[model samples]
Target: MGTALEDSEIYQKFARITDSLLSPEIEDFKDSGGKVVGFFCSTVPEELFTAAGMLPFRMRGTGSTSTELADTCFTPINCTFPRHCFNQALEYEFEFLDALIVINSCDHIRRIYDNWIDQLDEPEMIHVMSLPRKTGDRQVDWYREEIAELKGKLEEHFGIEITDDAISDAIKLHNDVRRLQRELYELRKVDRPPITGAEVLRVMVAGTALPKADYREMLQELIGTVRGLEGNGDHKARVLVTGSQLDDPEFIELIEGQGALVVTDATCFGTRLMWRRIDEDEPDPIRAMAQYYVHDRPSCPRMHGDQPRRLDFLKELVEEFKVDGVIGERMNFCDIWQVEHFMTGGDLKEEGISFTQVDREYILAGKGQLQTRVQAFVETMKGTD
Candidate 1:
């Protein structure tokens, strides 16, 4: 797999970005007077920032492997994902952020936003938007209004007007990126996938880090490059991964190293980021962005009354990817996935999908244990086959 992508500059660039919290390309963009907005979740409408001519960077706790500094501000009871984010902030890894946005996705993340805003001095502009837990007409309307309000704030702070034409163009650009991402995933459906899951996760994380235009072109080129190549061997078992924040591609590599190829996943940073597209035909781009993110985007456990919807999506992925088994991976202290995984266990069993749950810290340190469990699971999957 490594040799296959060695000559591909697009794959190499994205892989480099995944290794750091901030990339040289982004620094160059900001250096050229482009405003960069740092956002936490996909719930934040990135099209708005791109339309406003600012770079929308999805905040990842990459580059830093320890939470030592973050522990001073937060407790051990808090999930390591957010804590690691704080750790990076304290280390000045996110000093390039001109503005930051956070959504009310979970208790720990909400608290992370609060702490960042109250504790940090950088990120001159900080905003927190409440993500409604339910789905409906009223919620959609409210979310649109919230998006409008955010747009207004951005306009006022940046002294730039985000025109309708700009938003329309931004939507088109983002939609193209989604289309390319979907096409990339389609290549995985083959018996021997050309690209590995670890590489896919790195590309997905890079998609959130760099500008849309840059990522879109790279994805297009990479897709063309990979399709012309042959698949790497050792695709012993097709597996689907689901769970908490998977910001690290090394985690995916660990599973792939265990001989099970991860064909697809339901992680927040993985498939959920690019599976859906915004409707461009809708005259109101803002309303379209708000509606799609709230209703049509991949279901998160935080969204109440969507458990069945999430399971249905999981089942569809299993069948679509020809997955032989499912791995329910979660962080140790993540309450949301803890319960969601417990409930999903039976639902997957009823469908006869081989499911296993493994909990670890956000920054995985137990590669030996994880590899052992993954090996056992791969053997079990082969036995079933």
Candidate 2:
């Protein structure tokens, strides 16, 4: 018989949400007169949208199978993630979104904003945010001002006044989400976790798709159920996955299928977004958000001069989760992560860690090759033991 956690209604809901681009919750939210604002990157403070009575959606190219339409605008050298995203937009896959806020995370991603405005018709309220390349006092201040500008734009577009009190309330609400996710991650620290890495990825992706309050409630239920169940002791090695925008659960499933359990990850869609909490007590909510998003949280490769900090955080996860090997997966032609993986591979080797890099498309493909590599890596680790 399966465990209660495996058969839970909430777990099923998470899978259903992740399997599609527009989930039932999103359709219901829209039907009830709620506006949804899709944002490209994690750097965008979601609290602002929540405070302004809008749903903040973390945009992904989940269901995209081809970049046919987007190919006319973009070259083959660009990352496929953004190509698939733009393809989805061109196909009217994201027509439900009332607005889109793009961030200059990279040249390819920033191009989406331009292409979107030129092509799309329904989502008239499109905005672009300039993200700082490095972290510093000046950058923090600059981000804070940028956030304020976003707030002003929301107010102007929606005719809604987002008060400081409302932003504070939103911060508290999102912080609750961060706390619950962290608690869920803590469960993975055990030798035999009740939950699998694929399931955790589904839950994390669902959080980005659904309403915050609803997602939080489901997470609390999931954590409670999974905590009581006996852990699964059916894996050969524990692996830590880290790299570029991985929102697909099947990729983790592929790795796990090769006799390795993906215990944890440092990907943007996973730990990077949930690892840190914003200050609830800070008087200036915008400044607090800017500080947390820009400075405090785990920095992605786009942030210059932060590779050392990123490596330190990855090493800490390896120790905490008892990771056997680290797999660094990056999308093809991702210049930033290509450099990051090269640096990380050498650095991790110097620390006496097992590391391998995998280059893949935005959509999951080449499973046989990936499986062969993963199986060899797992067997190599077993041999070392």
Mark the 10 consecutive residues where model 2 has the least summed lDDT. Answer: 1-10
| Model 1's TM-score against the true structure | 0.97
Expressed as tens digits, the lDDT of each residue in 274-303 for candidate 2 is: 899899888999999999988999989999
Q: Which whole-number lDDT from 0 to 100 does residue 351 have in model 1?
A: 91
> Compared with the true structure, what per-residue lDDT tens digits does model 1 show for residues 1-385?
3648756887899889878877899989988998889988778999999998888988878877799988887888998889988899988889999999988888888887878877789888898898888878788889999999999999998888999899999999998998888898999999988998998888888888888998898888888888987887676799999986788888888898888898899987777877888889989999998888888888888888899999999999999999999999988788889889889978998999999988888887888999989999988879645
Candidate 1 lDDT at 13 equals 90
Clashing pairs in 1: none
TM-scores, in order shown? Answer: 0.97, 0.97
RMSD of each: 1.4, 1.5
Q: How many residue pairs clash in each candidate?
A: 0, 0
